[model samples]
Target: MHTPYFSDRPAAARSAAYRTLWRWHFYAALFVMPFLTVLAVTGTLYCFQPQIDPLLYPGRLLVAPATTPRLSEDDLLARAEAAVPPGSRPAAAAVGSDPERSAEFVFRYPDGRQHSVYLNPYTGEMLGTLSVEQRFMQRVRMIHRKLLLGKPGELLMELAACWTLVMVGTGIALWWPRGALTWRGTLWPRLDWRGRAFWKSVHAVMGIWLAAGAVAFILTGLPWSGSWGEQFKSLATRANLGSPPGVWGGSTRQSTIPGRQLARPANHAQHGDAVAGGRGMDGMPPMVMDDLPLPSTPWAVGATTVPGSGPAGGSAAALPLDRILDIVRANGIPRGYDVAFPSTPSGVYTVSYFPPDPKREHVLHIDQYSGEVLEEIGYDDYGAVSRLVSYGTSLHMGRYFGLANQLVCALISLGLAGMAITGFVMWWKRRPQKALGAPARLPTPVTMRRWKIGLAALGMVFPLMGGTMLLVWALDSLALKRRAMR
Candidate 1:
């Protein structure tokens, strides 16, 4: 008979430990396979969003390059406003550096729906309009993030992510090379092997190859999870290693105006009338930097208070869009920055510049009346943890190194999906009729001291996973005890 893989260990101990590990791996795979496939497919699609969007909506997203000067920002805004329905007001404007790209202005409707109006920069011709939520990439992102189920979906994804880490860990342990490793059935699958054996080799090999990339993808995405991400952000901020202190420019001013109130129908007599002259309705606090509908919001300053414009009665007119553009340019906010228009008298003009490189990201809050830059936070100002997260976020989205980065991410995503499929196939072939066909439980309890310690450490790091693991362990132990008594 062929010797078992763990030849160095005594036969009895090896048999028991291997069986236990196999059972654990089986349970993890059973839960993770479907979710892994879904995440992989959605992730691959989102990785190519930059190239995909233009192809999907070329008429709206692309334009002919022009050597002549483009229309002024205010003119473009005016044209975009005219293109939309009467009640729709411009919320934000995104200017691209590329001459071939059309200018995009986002408008919020009375019912809180947002639409993107595309305008040809050179001639101010209205290209087309699209619902922001219904856009192809945005839909893909929502599915990937929360399965379109809102908070409940978010919790499920987070739990899936936590379980995915467990699956990866158990997978690596099971795939670890044993005594006398060789390329066959290890680095490369044995093509000559038949049926279940052949598929097992392929699954194991692919799992190992994709392990590191999968782990990175999972860890990076955890920061965006609703539960764990929120707790992590709070902890990091408390440690002063996340958003940094006083980044709000020493301005304690806050507006009582809420975004929903501002989003009400423009049919109201005055702009302030809808929001009750910026006093806020129903005790709703003023919208913060996070409330604006910018295409990209930095992780560091998302929660920072939005400063109010100073000297309310000094001048009835808020600073014009053109003047704000001048201020942005003077402050060296590069091309491709987004300008979010003020919604109330106390609201500031929010400018966000998010480039492919995380190091160049910047956010500026400008007073609508005085044209003063109330608060400015750039990548350099981010604390150590915040900076690290910035880089991770960019890399997670495959924006760090351009095409090469996206290609690498795509390959990893596809590899993960392939592994999930092959794992399912292997399990299906071996599964007995009318049963789950999980690996059989070992007859006796086995000492897995090192494994337990490692698991404990992992649980501490991820509290949600830790809690679930404890519950599973308790249930498993009870089942084992019952089996022994029988």
Candidate 2:
């Protein structure tokens, strides 16, 4: 018959197993503590992604459709330029999958500069912009992610990731069964603080209590790998609960640019245009016919991905924005859809649907040349991998639970920060004199004796101690240059 096992007393002289585990746990604990500190802070701040985004962006991120008719992309671009300071340009627009969140215009300014007033996508109204730096949570996240140290800070954090795994391994080992008849020393926290046994037990027991969920959270934080994590993402996607990746949008769909061409270049640009000469070998006329107002030497407009939106079988006809937008709307496409006007004869007018839930993206490529619908695919249309990727994106950002989820992750980070502080205090009280890793100071005899076994018991469990061991070894062998010079 099977029974639940918990113990402190080593079984029948099998203290060896307990000893091995004890060593492993100590090694893992040392590095993991600091890593968890960073993870906790960053994770907590990231939890509020949804709330913070709306607050930071205000009416721009979410705004109901205009009472007036939606302005054309050209009109919106003109408005954005007129509204922002000179030399400013539109970076990208948000295509609302939700009508209530509809605002197509998004303008990004020069790097390092802040925008206080943003134009509304749906109505071309000037929506207010606020400073993200002023928010408390935002400031906290900045510290957690970068230690307020910028690039160097991020590098330090990346180096800390490996230590977290080590902690998990050693923690499990230390938490393993110690004895058959006794367990009070393992499961519950001991209040007998005067006893060394009590506090050690508290740290171990509390760690184990949170281990399962804590481990899961750690695994969840990493999107690229962890057991059958991909399968779970797949399941989420099959249910149509897909999220996009952080820092990258789900797809590379183009939004409507003004199609305003700058002046032709000084040299071969005009020659090339002269050769194409208002008509191509195919049917369409020159994209820039009159070559108005001495076009600025072919500066790049927002790049249109050519040959990307061409019809699956053949090219579609060239059409006006009015016709293309009308076809898109009539096809049951929402106002939030990305409308890409064709740049070349072969290029088609394309529309991509990327919802807050990326799974809702409905991609359609229409032949702009012919105004013919080329291809249409919805959330159900994606392959297994695509769907999995979307959901994983959302879960990584805690979009799965919305505000409640973000809040929980944020709190966990704060708890981790607290753990770091307490852990450092505990460490401080026990710091050895004559340097941390030096051999224990002998009494008058300078004896080789001094309780080596007990000291080994403590040091072997902490890998940070192992690192200290290496450092000592370096000095002992004169491998350290300072030692060598001496």
Candidate 3:
């Protein structure tokens, strides 16, 4: 009963399990480190966009305070249109409440690019023109989302995000104290430790502190991913947890033209007004609601159909910009909102009010000819899931609580970057010369039924990650077999 084999079985199993988990943790860190660092840096830069933009383009975005009443919306629009190149169409105008800020008018160039023409609201003088892609923060956002490589880049980022979850999970397990915890090596790093030991302690302590924030950042960001975001949106909408029934009201009319055809290229830039060119249909432009006019919309009503304008009764001409402004004020849609002009005779004027607070977000579709508010969706009408997402989006962008929110998000981002650097240093110091220096594979792999089941469950939740895992497993099995033969 007390044989040596029986006595050592539990210890051997524990050792095998630890090695296997350590190997997996190493692999996950290797894959996600570079991506996580890039995301962290870019995300930090974007979080401070409010402060950075003014310093970057003062002449274009800033203006001297004026005692005189600002020029009317129509006058500003006219000046903006006159300042643009020939063949440019005025798409939207953003009215800001700030007394010292310039007005912004978005225009669609003949070549399909969207540009913003800035004007001094007080004098109706052209401040400057900047393309959507030209803005520094927008560029950082694109890189953060897509790595500037388009679809492939987006997929890579998604894959990295998925693996980051795994990395964090395994990192926690590795950092977990086995024996009684001590302050020096558990909650805080032992600064007196030498070489790899010191670096490892730093990495472990930082990771433990960052664990909650890292998870939150990753989950909040998933809603914006190309693949997972779309699927989740479709699922939430179907469950009535997105837009909810009848939010579109009695209007069942769909745009004959697809939103994509009317929308700018997939890479459309969002600036002061954050106007996305049109609702897109494939590659063609269509007059749809989602991603039309405003580049960003509340997640819940993103796919809600835009109501079309009826035929004009007396005058076929659309309502004047001043009239729309009057309606906006009358409806109490805060002072700073973007007005998207109807692209076609049947198109409706779209007013989107996206403030820093999610509760005040609003979108109104007004009949271009009759000036009737065809459909209005506000934060109060959003489904539970949509409301949650709206709040999360605000937090992710560091806009929820102003400066405090920005500082918290910045710290998290920079913390992640620091963890990556520390991890790399730890690996480099101990890595064997002239080798990949990965953790050695177990000589006799232990049967880890529970671990396998947990990993399988995770893979199911993220299909892309699951598929990659299968491929890696197959390749590893082949390598093991070859090594055994040798």
Best candidate, lDDT-wise? 3
Report how far off residue 438 is in candidate 2 (Å): 11
Between candidates 2 and 3, name the one with more favorable lDDT.
3
- lDDT scores for all predictions? 0.78, 0.46, 0.78
TM-score of each: 0.89, 0.54, 0.90
RMSD of 3: 5.2
lDDT of 3 by residue, 185-281 (tens): 5889989899999999999999999999999998888877888777776666557676645533323422222112233322222122223534333
Q: In model 1, what is the error at residue 430, expressed in angstroms?
A: 0.5
Please list all clashing residue pairs in model 1, or write none if there are none.
none
TM-score of model 2 relative to the true fold? 0.54
Ranking by lDDT: 3, 1, 2
Query: Which residue runs of candidate 3 sit more than 4 Å off their true CA positions?
Result: 1-9, 180-184, 246-287
Per-prediction RMSD in angstroms?
5.1, 12.8, 5.2
C-alpha lDDT of candidate 1 relative to the true structure = 0.78
Give the candidates in order of TM-score, highest first.
Answer: 3, 1, 2
True lDDT of residue 367, candidate 2: 70
Model 3: which ten-residue window has the lowest total lDDT?
265-274
